[model samples]
Target: MKYLKTRFQWIRWAVHIGALLPLVVLIVDALSNHLTFNPIQAATQRTGDTAIILLGLSLACSPISTYLNWKDAVRLRRTLGLYTFIYAAIHLWLFVGADYGYQFNYIVPEFLQKYYLWVGLPAFIILLALAATSFRGAMRWLGKRWKRLHRLIYLGAILAMLHLALVIKGDALRLSGDAWKPLLAGIIIGTLLILRVPRLRRALLSLRHKPVAPAAVQLASPPAESTLVKN
Candidate 1:
């Protein structure tokens, strides 16, 4: 158990580094003026993509724990979820602050014109709530209700995928243009959700715990027994 704890600690640190690396790269790129023709747009898209990827990872924790019997994976959920929110917040800020100069007039008009913007709003709100109540204190305060609230992450994931599908320059239904990203995201998210089903999860757990059959042992020749009788 101590070894497991130490291993989990290492994994946690790795996750921390992995999660923050994208933001660091983004900042470095911005500093070096390497964010392509539209820096703000590039930053916004990158941050949003990172957030969705983290969110998918967070959602994967339970399935991984069940299927692989890696209990440590569940512990990483909160960390991943928090990172998802961090990137999501940054993504939104880039949209409203960097892209629109934090001008409500311009932001509101864009929101009204863009269906994807409003579609993503609820996902961000859900992430905000989950992040706010992610601590031990909040867990204690919410008790059983905390889980119910956090489950909304799945809904948020769905909305986020829709937002991505809409924002990209393609028809998701027709599978053309830049639709592959969101389609892939949807498939992954859908698989994660399916794995969370109680029956499937229980089946996976059973498979993990199932005992292996022992090999049958064969006896040697009876000639040895005749020699032992002489004693």
Candidate 2:
């Protein structure tokens, strides 16, 4: 158990580093002009992509933990989810602020004009709701309802993938990099949903917490000689 604890501690730190790597790469790319001629598009794409990936990973935390029996993985879920929202906020800001020049009036007309905006909007709302209730105090206040509220994450994941699918170009079966991104994300979201079904959740949770068999201890068997034991 101690060994497991130590390993998870290291893994948690590693996850933290891994989660931040996207931001670091984005910064370097922006400064180096590696994002290409259209930095806004590249920035938005990269940020949006990272947000979706993080959101999916956060959503996967429970199923993965249950599947792999890594109970401690729950500790990282909140962190990953929060980062997911942060990236999402950045993604929205880039579009609303930088792309549209902060024209509040344009927000609605634009959503009406663009189908992808509608799909992304609901997912963003769900992300906001989850983020608002994510803290310890909110968890304590919400109690059992906390779990129910967080279940909205699955819906958010679906809508996010839908938004991606709507925005991406090229044939779904194409070998190009951008063509496959949404399909891969969709598959991940679908797997998570399957693992989240009630029957599967219970089965995985049961396996996750099931106790291991104890090692046999060597002892002499003197049952006949010690027959007076319980008499």
Tens-digit lDDT track for model 2 on 1-231? 447667997888888898889989999999998988998888899899999899888878887676765678788899999999989998898899977889979887888898888889899999999999999999999999999999898889988998998788766766465768888898887998899899988875665454533331124534542332212
User: What is each predicted model's overall lDDT from 0 to 1?
Assistant: 0.88, 0.84
Q: Pick the candidate with the highest TM-score.
A: 1
Report the CA-based lDDT of candidate 2 relative to the real structure: 0.84
**Residue range with the least summed lDDT across 10 consecutive positions in model 2:** 212-221
lDDT leader = 1
Sequence-dependent TM-score of model 1: 0.86
Which pairs clash (backbone N, Cα, C closer than 3 Å) in model 1? none
TM-score of each: 0.86, 0.82
- State the lDDT of candidate 1 residue by residue for 108-135, as single tens digits: 8888999998889999999999999999
For all candidates, what are the clash counts?
0, 0
Model 2 error, position 224 (Å):
43
